[model samples]
Target: MKKSSETAAADRRLSTVARHLITTTTNNEEEENGSFMISSSPTAAAGQSVFSNIVGAPEDPILGVTVAYNKDPSPVKLNLGVGAYRTEEGKPLVLNVVRKAENLLVNDRTRVKEYLPIVGLADFNKLSAKLILGEDSHAIRGNLVTTVQCLSGTGSLRVGAEFLARHYYQHTIYIPNPTWGNHTKIFNLAGLTVKTYRYYDPATRGLNFQGLQEDLGSAPSGAIVLLHACAHNPTGVDPTLEQWEQIRRLIRSKSLLPFFDSAYQGFASGSLDKDAQSVRMFVGDGGECFIAQSYAKNLGLYGERVGALSIVCRAADVASRVESQLKLVIRPMYSNPPIHGASIVATILKDRNLYHEWTLELKAMADRIITMRKQLFDALSARGTPGDWSHILKQIGMFTFTGLNTKQVAFMTKEYHIYMTSDGRISMAGLSSRTVPHLADAMHAAVTTVV
Candidate 1:
């Protein structure tokens, strides 16, 4: 009886402590004003939290860099995260041609805010196909090419994936090993099996041509392969024209379908024709292929989200049926694309003077990115930072894979106010002459101090 009484007293003491702790927590929570600590509506009287069971999703690594960079209050903070082009002053840029086109649209009172057709503007589709697949493309002249306006590169890719998923003979898709992150997600979500072919070689920081050939040769006939039309993202490594011809021959011989994601057309070589040689090579051969063209990077119409998907088939009869099915894929999702962005692109592309001016501005942007790469390379060299920095100069387009690991990336973010993806990918467009030294110092410290 005495032992039972002692246990009862201990239970009472524990209950008293638990109650005190609850009261203290409640009072502290009520006193806190910061959003980090307390909810905006802290009281239960407002409404019950219906999303209580929903788990917190992890932050997007790419976009999360921008978010973190924006939140940092440091004056020296640098954002080498997003691939969006920026002026030398580190400001987002809209091309003069884009502005001129917008003005033309604004002044033309005949233009209305009416919704576009399910297939999109006829002229925009025709012009976009011509832009990617030369003006004299026999497939287009023969009515064997089906073009549809979709969202920018990502949207175009998604729409194309959906169409392929529904109609293509095979379900397996071979993407590059170090491809744009969205490639895997987009294709997989479309209900297709995603596979990877060797592309980026870490040791050389270049293309693994032999491995790529072996992988493609081994893939089953009719398997779909995603090709970076130009200016491969993240890694910035692309196969040479000679290598591309060999790849095309192999793919054609194997009867594998090629889906070209042409995000950076004029942004790579600064010459549209030079950048499009690979796609044109495949098209010139009389086989089937898919192309997704984006105006975001080249034309600076990112917010406008203008792009198109072109399917080159064997004959006009097949293309007609394919286009009809593409309508079914788009009708349920978005129904039709936004008209303004497509209108802007169509205007500039159609006008000779504007097209020339657009190419000049596009070249300027590409040249600036190349200059930044050189500046960064020179800066790193001057500091005598360990490792071969030559890849900075060799890698093409807006991004450079810096070879920095995850821990080093975190160190740079914490010690210096520099931001980039954990995979060590930095947007060359985001770098400037002014910020090169800061990045150099941070990188030097990141590499030397850590290991």
Candidate 2:
């Protein structure tokens, strides 16, 4: 009995030891499996260390150029990187008309600071639509046009893009190649694919009419084509009236929807009507279209963030339906646009005397840009800079595409402290009488040195 009891005790001890070994082996296997799982996953590796997998985004090309320009202490530094206009002394400008308009608004003492409708102020919308599409437009007359105030040009474009994405099934938007850089981002963010059509030809230093037409012709029917109403951005090249007509016909034939971005209107040609010719033509042809208008450039109200988006439809009922959908798109993006800028624009447009004065001021600004273009052209020509400088004068509005290669542009910046886009687009408004000669000298040196 004593021996049997001892054996049982031994058996129990052995069983206890086996159980311990099994647990130890299972824990070791678990540790190995966990390490293998972590090693297998890139995400798990990233989780293992905070700084291990971070990648920085590239700097914005234009903003980076501006930052470099700002850091320079050179007295003769010229910033033509941005499109904002500057005076003869190279200072930012605020129009006198804007001041008067502000005074008028203050004098009226309009109350009600409550949230505006998603469509924005009624008077602002009415005047904005009239300004873009003639007051006598059939769409307006038939009550087939709907306008909604938005957060300046970019915001307006985003809202319009969203509206198109939600209501219209045309999933692709065709923009000009070398378009304002933000256009692609805006449309794509709104769930639409952005494709490009040929626009500027660097070799000719001008518009590629044949390429543009071919691209338009080849685009799928019912696709959306974005057109710069006037003074094409970046390139400063515009299609002639004849070319615009042809484009209009092709768009109509292909059943492609037209979206006009009229940011520069009055600032383009100093005549609002002339700048709006393209949009008016499209509207007059009884084609459904969209117009995004900004008061930033024309009214010198950049900070005010005032703009409108208008949709032209086949009938008043359709216009209402389209506007309702636009409201839905805008509600989530921004509850409502600010009131100060819209009130200022409405005040100016309502008073005939103020309106006339504002027109003169706009014309003056436009004329100054035109004169700068001429001066730059003459300066380049006098210096005998290689290549055609005529495009300087030929191009209208605030920018002049100098056709300078990237190397020449870097040379200009490094040697002369002249800041411009790598694409060689120089804002003529930034060139004052005092700096024109200096810019000309730099261009001359760069060109000759390259030769």
Candidate 3:
């Protein structure tokens, strides 16, 4: 009886200790949950005490416009923020020439999907150089031009910038005022100081010729000056032939290095030869220059990302050295350019018939954009929008600087669902016959209502 009684007391004591332990654990868990809840609270999360101290970065100006446009629920919203060319129906277009080229590439059973050389395909580079520098270019005859395939215009620009940053002693690159939004970033990232020369004048809403001449004239000799070879971006205001000659002379006299960004070659005037005149003239003059050419706008190969960069030099020895250095720069950047786009371009350029067909198709696209410009101008004039609308037709390429202030642009977005850059540039390619009148009306309202 004594043993059984002792056992029962011990069991009761053990059970009491077990219940105390369970209650302590439960209390600790609840405390942990409360602490976590406090840490994760909205106020706490936003505070430095709870989260890391890194600040969020702002969205890209060009791409951010697209993001805002996408979120807009209005059915009438038009996205004129980007530089991409669109059909009259406001849809992205793939050129018929590109399709034909692709078909030819597919039919070539012997062609292998092999790695391209570090610089890119030999034939593609040769053909690309010929296309930009002309068939009888002295640089080609003398073998003084080093060409490399790149990831479209932007990529080509980046690669060229990097090469300059590494090799060129004068690391300062002078870009035009109100140039491509990304030019400054590209050069800065490439480890060069970015400077600007006068190009645009707000008072006249056109090129400031005197300011430009003075800026270039005063720029430090040997400094790199980036030139829009044809169809200047954002403004669409290009220097006339005479202006180009004077600019070229000044650049040569100042010993400034010229870097031509030829993004809209054939797309600008619908004639490849006409569009290539500036680049050809510079090269023909024995001026050491860099040319970055994109097939995106001209061939409608945006997604394919095809482009080339050619560096013209005074001698074959220098050209060879430059080519080697360019290969080194390209090695780490992307290793090599894509094969498909290069192949398509090569196939088209190699065949005479395909090349002729491609030119016609290019002309058609350019002609359509020209037509849109006239239509938009006519619509604006008919509506008597309280301003001279002739600049719409005067400007070339896919865009027109509408000279609308930020408030007017905002008004258009809020009241009429018409989207455009805050800088007042509109993508003429985005306007169709059906939408031109509507866009003109919206512009008229914004212009008159705001003031």
**Best model number under lDDT:** 1
Superposition error at 344 for model 2 (Å): 0.7
TM-score of 1: 0.89
List per-prediction Cα lDDT, in the order shown.
0.88, 0.84, 0.84
Q: How does each model score on TM-score?
A: 0.89, 0.88, 0.88
Stretches > 4 Å off in candidate 2? 1-54
Clashes of each: 0, 0, 0
Q: Please write out the lDDT profile of model 2 over residues 184-208, one tens digit for every residue.
A: 7677656666788999998888999
Quote the positional error of residue 139 for candidate 3 in Å: 0.8
Superposing all C-alpha atoms, what RMSD in Å does each candidate have to the true structure? 13.3, 16.4, 17.5
The digit string of per-residue lDDT tens for model 1 on 20-135 reads 33432333222121101212333354465754443343446678889999999999999999889999899999999999999999999999999999889888999999999998
Which candidate, 1 or 3, would have the higher lDDT against the true structure?
1
Task: Report clash pairs, candidate 1.
Answer: none
User: What tens digits encode model 3's per-residue C-alpha lDDT throughout 145-240?
Assistant: 999999999999988987886677687888998887788767765666778899988777789999999999889989999999888988999999
